[model samples]
Target chain A: MVCELCAVAKKEVESELLYEDNEIMAVVHLKPAIPGQIIVFPKHHYPIFEQVPDKIIAKMFKIANKLGIALFESLNCHGTNLLINNGVAAGQTMAHFSLNLIPRKEKDGLKLQWEPKKASEEELQTAFLMINEKSKELHPDLFGREEKNEELVEERGRPKEIKLDKKKENYLLKSLKRLP
Target chain B: MPEEEYSEEERKAFEEKIKRMSPEELKEFQKRNCVFCQIIIGQIPAKKVYEDDHCLAVLEINPAAPGHILLLPKEHHAIMPQIPEEEIGHLFMAAKHLSHALLRGLKCGGINLFVANGAVAGQKFQHFVIHLIPRKESDGIKLELPQREIPEDILSKINEVVQNRFNELMGIKKELVKVETKEHAEKKKEAADEEESEKKKEETEKTDPQEEENEDEKSEESEEEKDGSISLDDIASVLNGGR
Candidate 1:
């Protein structure tokens, strides 16, 4: 169940270790588009960008913002690209959620190379809506079981078998029991 | 401050009002200020699929991918910091089921969960909600990481601490979502009924004579303008010629 991204995520932390919190992590990009092209990610390993919880996602963005400020002041190019590629067709090469904060300059040329197409107004509207409606369906809970081998192949890669804490589990169980 | 006192009649009136409220009113009251809450309440409409007592899952108006759904707490708080423990469980549980529905129902290629806790964190919704974004390999979403090795101890520690917190949070969310969703499908149906009102409103407006008159006038005005109708350009030409 070795996803390339997860293998890399699990392999080891490298030079991009700008910041690391329990819930969040930041690193410099491997193939940076701009000079200080840093990308920040949540350690939780949410498979897609949208499915990450609001709280965790917020924290990740806060870290991203801090990095954005850093890149703006220290690196001093022009602006930064806080890019996130959601799916394969959208240009996603990795499985984990990340915000690519690539520093930008006016002339340095990094274009998305977008070619907008017409979808036959009505059909285009339907397609426009289809993206949101369908994505709404595929939630991070897609791989629900605490651990699944296939999910490991699919999502954040099998969460490494870090030791479980009884106290935490108990706390979760008790809280969940009171859900109603 | 002491609880505001209500006389018997007042209390009775309040009960009556509650009864009269129509789920729309309750939902308005339920959400303090979240636009997403407004979307759920039919003040605005969203493409919704999965719903339960505790929460509703809807497609994001602005989507990052093909299957991006916004998971909202039916009852609104500004953010997770404001949500009660019971609510936390309720939300995630609904999210879990909705996610499954997405995978099997929609046949999504993959799924992701997202949430924003605060303003600095890109939380566009004032009312707390999580986003469930579906994925395709071509979407180009990945976590940028260091190319070199991170110490095992550091990684282990990060995993240990985060998992404990995540399990706690996720566990609570699962419970709440499961418990509340099952209990309130009937209430949710009542809410759905309000959308019928929205559709009826649309139908009436579509058929309304005044609306038709306005459309006719607008069309006539545009046609005349297109057909060399009076305009500043004509006046400017007239002025130039006179000069």
Candidate 2:
């Protein structure tokens, strides 16, 4: 089955397209959670947030921020919510990753808030150590080593397109097909 | 004057003072009042999970889940609109990593990255923050965003208004110009990066005076104690049924 958001990105389906550029698209949500809610997604088919490249994620968020400000101005709402449900358990209905910019007002009766749960001191400490170590391990590239290399490569010539290996590509396609 | 009348007069004078202040002064005043800024500057102790130059991630004292984290930018931005695009990008990138860490650390099923831009959106604090809530099956957190069928005409009207406003904010002509070759896009991105770095330098310089002001306020006000302290009983109850 064709991804619904892919259709939206390609403009195959009728959508209230708000903004479009080379890499991203923003359109007004049809069945909105709130009035003036907009959905922003990348042109490429990334089934999950982790699959999307860092640069595209950044670009999507920056665009979402702009659209968020637009919602505030146009709808005259009190605020906006930038929400991303990354997996099935997190209430991600669609396989295609998208960001929701929900316009909100005072006492709008949106039930997004949760009662804060308390974790034990040991649990909190373990979490802190585990996350700190994992973050340090995963975020070295973001701290400017590989990013500089990519920039240098781009400066030298045309930016290199990242090609996934055949196995990884197959895995991604399989996962996409597996998801509803 | 009566005591109530005297206090009301004082409150009015304070509001007038705030209104008369410059933008920089207003920012400093807000910074002095923000609790998160105090947490960032080491005035208030927090259980920090991650910290970089651009942002800090701390475990929520009252977490929605076991490892829920609140990622905050070091600078004072009251809302999403006030933040620069580059800073927004950086913050989200950091958030992505933090979410990943939450998943791996807590062994949760998923993650929800949530940001409330203003008071009506359930933003209790004045500081801009991104909430990374770790999700497990039957976690009992209901962040259900139920869809409503809006009228077609209303959607169209909203579309036009928001699209026009967005284009205006983004500079429509500049966006049109940006539709060009890959080389041109790369060049433009590099130029934007340089400009962002320059802006960061200017912001750091601007924050120095605010830091001094914060120090003065710190001396004047004894840190007011805040509740919501974690306890083992609360955690035991959460572990038993909440999650």
Candidate 3:
């Protein structure tokens, strides 16, 4: 199936391009969030943020910082915002992944606020404890007494499947089915 | 165009508040709503560029310019502050090279790097990403900010709540208990030796200690307290089944 970004990167669709290398492409947004807003994306289609490699992500940021500097110097904008929309819930429109770089001036009418919400002490502790526990599973090298065995590192990305004897499987299925 | 400026400290505090949400919350928030994951797994087609073991770079369908690119890690991370610190440098290094290419290739005046962390911050997608926007004279782009005033009491209350919660989560004010353990002593000795060597290297190379600390944070080891009894493990495990 044809993807819009794929078409642009492949030159199947005409675009006013800025830069292109073997692995990435930069283009001006047709309907930019702001006038000087630009969208930077990988040439290949990677629809989500979590699955992209670290090195490539680093490269993207390095480029972004440079662009940010350029915007400050050349465009005369006071600052910039590096924006990414990750999922449908976050208001991501395109199926493919992209970042929006928007130039900023003083009092330009964008309002990004973190209005505080009240939470009970119990709720606050629950939040803290959940992250505290999860951090152990996440960074064993830091919190846990034991190091992450080599076995775990080798199994980092791939999904794991559990094997059980038929009797055990049947028992498990029965128990789960009995849940109200 | 209007600029909304916050002190570095304020920005950090805001980021921390946003990141206070657990990873599970982010994961639940994503829930197969990711199109980028599909591309990585080769379920969907995209224009190919650079690919490595950890991340990928691609072009935007709706171009801000000719060479607009999006860089991201292969792993799905929705929040910016929650990303592993080590991975951050990698993303920026690639972006630096791309900026140079743009400078040489495009007829642009400058570039902008924009990131929105949450829905309130104009983040349309749940994925964590950075944008590179090129700018020129009379490009007509504007980022406007409207100022607001909060009552002193409300502001102080916000500060008290966030600060108190953050301290608890990070174990900032927990009194250090002296529990003499052989393991603790051995680790301390080893850490001292390592620090001595690191100091010597710093003397010779004049490397910034701050950068090193940032990198170490990614590995989850910190300089302050190596293995204290009042650690996250103790706090987290206690709540496991009780909640």
Candidate 4:
């Protein structure tokens, strides 16, 4: 519900529509956490950042980098935050996906409020171990990516069946609540 | 009119197409029209390029190369990011086969398989299509990737950033599979679908940050050669012309 940005056209008023193209739109965030806050948004309204295709995501950054540099030069800012909130639980107030460019200056008095929760040596090791095992358990089918085109041609001959596993489904739901 | 204005007509036409779908409808667009979906349903028609129980591939009508095809799941979903570890392996295995087949089918050169997710990345259709842009040296296929040397430290940071994103996608995949709500599943998938592109961006950034900068600078002078952009011949011409 939050990706109202895509449907919006800046009509040379209200907020500045910095850039526009077939794949994404770069617009000035009306409520700038910093004076030059901009959001590089994909034209399509995908709910989470990952669900959108990879190519578009790549291009968005390519443009964003350009804009980031422009924001750096034009605004003469110190640092920048290239951020996207993934899900509702992850402080994602809006369902629509986009990246935020928060330009930082010396004394604007804005901070991310990130307090480090460092783990002890053993705890950190165990955490790393568990995550490593999870990494090894990777399934190629996990992302539904196809590597080549001939297979797509060959696929022309097969029947489509979308599969969803119940156990992992539950595990995933439980996991989202504690997203790191 | 603003000084650097884009076309309003194109944007409006584009908007009309985008608005027709509810998110639920958008998710189903692929399942309903996807060749794999059709193959599963025994609808439409296709010449199978490759197949396994979990995934498959088919020919693209409008091919970027001679053996252009699409590799996808037998079960339809848009560009999803995180998948089960096993499923990720299988998908890669499917890709391996397609790469070989592509070698067989095209007979000439390299593979440039990529997916364009959102409209901003030029995903002309809503079906989460991956463009398996096959490249042949003779065929003049070249990707317009900028080449530059990134600082090793910066590259390391980028690697860490991508790795984190990759994990985030994995988590997202779990979330999608769990919810059973089409919206939830689709939403999570959007984030994962983008990983390939982002990783590639990092790759490009690593290889040549200057390429994009060069392309942008040269756009005005070489508008004629731009359509024929990303060709080895074009690169050679530019390289030779530079000297």
Candidate 5:
């Protein structure tokens, strides 16, 4: 079966390619939920989110963050949402995995919010126990590994230098710059 | 109770004060006002699920679904753009693992990994968080993002602007790469060169006659089965005592 996203990656489909590297690509969504919605995905076809390797997932999200910031700066959007629908039940339509970075505005008529459904204390506790137990089992290193001494040394040192260019500097300086 | 209203002059004074504050002072101020920071520091209580050096995951008090989790960075960051690349990578790695745990524990079909970066995007808090919402078929939670018909001219215009801005950001990243140690850069280049030669070897192997087609067909079939294993039909059947 031909994957639509793989076609997009190969430039077989008409997509506005926003960014590309060896492992990933970002494109303007052909049918955007919002005007500046961008879709970021791996160039290699991964059928689901869980199948992607850890390194590529990390790089994918890092690039997604950059693209989201681009939406903020270019479109003058009020905000952005990084959304992943991991499976069909979660509303994932395509077989290939991707992340949607949607530009948002106040009262934009996008209904992404859900009313809070209160679960009972007993149910909550049961979920907590089951999930916590399984999580610990799955990630033994995260739970059982001794705290590394290097982390403390790094924290005490001066923070990592994140050099911001002049444009970014202006954005950071104005607290309410994006706010109306 | 009467609502206390600030005069226009008072509001202007507050804005001016904020404008005059340095970035560090701004961060400190945001930290003080942030509730998630309090939760991270153990000043406020939370339903903690997982903790590591760089992040903390807690069960959402008001959840969209059972086993819904909020994954947060330990340090205070107001938005995604403010976070460094490495930290962003670490947080998502943790998120992936947490999603795996939810799928196994809750026996759910899927998970929604969501991040709202600003107030307009439903970011209720100042701190950064990734919401891991467990999902099953026909769960009442709705995330409706309706696709509207934008004019051709507008679409192309947006495409151009976003492309230019993304290029500018990439330029900034290139500058950051220049600061890496020479030794580290050399190591990366060496690794890339090795991988390129290995890829060339694989391409040569793929040119063989009948064996290549069979191998390709087998790999494709395996990939299909792997994808089909997580489909809703299979999960639904499992839920219906077919497991």
Candidate 6:
């Protein structure tokens, strides 16, 4: 229930804040790979990408684009690298979802190179057809109540009252009000 | 303009041609050929995790891990830089939701989001996509960041070059003179010679009736020369050279 990112969004935890809006926040990473490496995330506790609503995702990316442009312009870096570590296998350290906006310069010693496995034309076509066929049977009604309704049931199972520390509660309430 | 009328037989033949053609062949006819584009239009099927009018997220066929997803806009874009400004942010927003889905749906520990722009960045497919690679403990899929030590002088020179390129991309022309001088001072005192050549750019624009056409060619040339603009191979080569 008490997530680090939730705490940060609620102002329970102090972070190097860059930009914050009602839907999302951009903060400096504690251990930066580059000078201006930033982490942008949604204000609410959405651990992974799929749980958040489309509108919320759009807002987060809007912030990311702004942060990216600002990062390049203000920092004077050669280019920028925007990355997100989704699940644990992808080198995701934190459980909370966040996008890493890394400032890249020539010979900055920041390397994200990988040897690609070659796929034959046939193999590629096979994969393409499989994915294509499966896509047709997917959730046709975009942003339907199906997933959200399930989440509501999950929420109802949890304890109704959350006993927050008095100081933290006040801070969290203030932060909540501060949000548009 | 009125829509062209096709005879029923001709239309039937065209449909048959479409069925016979590979995706690449479809591209030659200026049809939607990219697999991801086809998915967007619902022509090709996908095990879609998320979809909205502006964007869509689908399960990757050869996933690096369980719940690995590919997020993209409904519109097709070959590379990140070429993506429309408005659609750029929405794709990642969708990815955020997909990441949450993987965490809860598959119960993965963490996640990694990767965007491979050109071929050098391991971008096999031409269509721009953000790969949502799920991370779990001991999954063994590595994202390596190998560091190398280089001499300070060379490092500074590299920095200057990269900075100049970035400045040019950002359209900060005022700093061009200062950047060129810094670059030339280190390599040699060839600063005056380059400056004279650089002055020709502005002069040509003023004198030429086909200035717009000339500018287009110059940009294309500069694009090839610009390190990490078209491909990151230039930067990679420099780093490798230093080692």
What would the per-residue lDDT of candidate 2 be over residues A41-155, giving only the tens digit for each residue?
Answer: 9899876666666687788998998899888876777789999987666777778888899888655667788888778898788877878776656554443253364543233
Candidate 1 chain B, which ten residues in sequence have the lowest lDDT sum? Answer: B172-181
lDDT of 4 by residue, A51-139 (tens): 45545654665565556555544444555545444333234444466767655554444433221233354543433343223322332
Q: Can you write out model 3's per-residue Cα lDDT over B107-196, one digit (the tens) per residue?
A: 344444546655534565566665544445444443222223323322222223323333344346843233334455557567766775
Off by over 4 Å in 4: A9-15, A136-180, B1-243
Q: What share of the true interface contacts does candidate 4 keep?
A: 0.00
Stretches of candidate 2 exceeding 4 Å from the true structure: A141-179, B1-6, B9-13, B16-22, B173-243
The digit string of per-residue lDDT tens for model 1 on A58-132 reads: 456555555555554443445544555544433455656566765445455444322223334453355435543
Reference-based TM-score of each model: 0.36, 0.73, 0.37, 0.35, 0.70, 0.48
**What are the per-model C-alpha RMSD values against the true structure?**
28.7, 22.2, 26.4, 26.5, 19.8, 15.7
> Which stretches of candidate 1 lie above 4 Å from their native place?
A1-13, A128-180, B1-243
TM-score of 6: 0.48
lDDT of 2 at B44: 88
Instruction: Give Cα-based local distance difference scores for all models.
Output: 0.50, 0.74, 0.50, 0.46, 0.74, 0.56
Candidate 1, residue B164: CA error in Å? 31
Model 2 residue B15 distance off true place after TM-score fit, in angstroms: 3.7
Give the per-residue lDDT digits (tens) of candidate 2, residues B1-243: 123444888899998999999999998888887889989999889998866666878998888876889999999988888888877877777677677667655656678999998877888778899999988668887765687776665666577667878999888843322122345445655665665567668796776666566456543432211111233233223212311
Report the lDDT of model 3 for residue A22: 72
Top TM-score: which candidate number? 2
Q: For model 5, how does the per-residue alpha-carbon lDDT over A28-88 read when each residue is reduced to its tens digit?
A: 8877777778889999987667567777888899889888888888777788998988766
**Candidate 5 chain A lDDT trough over 10 residues, lowest sum:** A171-180
Model 4's CAPRI class? incorrect
Q: Give the true-contact fraction for every prediction, in order.
A: 0.03, 0.71, 0.09, 0.00, 0.69, 0.24
- Residues B71-178, candidate 4: write the lDDT tens digits: 666655543332233443345444433543343333323444444333332344433334444455444433322123323322222222222333343243321121
Predicted candidate 6 versus true structure: per-residue lDDT over A1-180, tens digit per residue: 466677888998876566666988877655555545667888877544445566666566666655665555545555666776654345545556677766666666666644334545454454444433333333222234445544533442332222223562242233333333
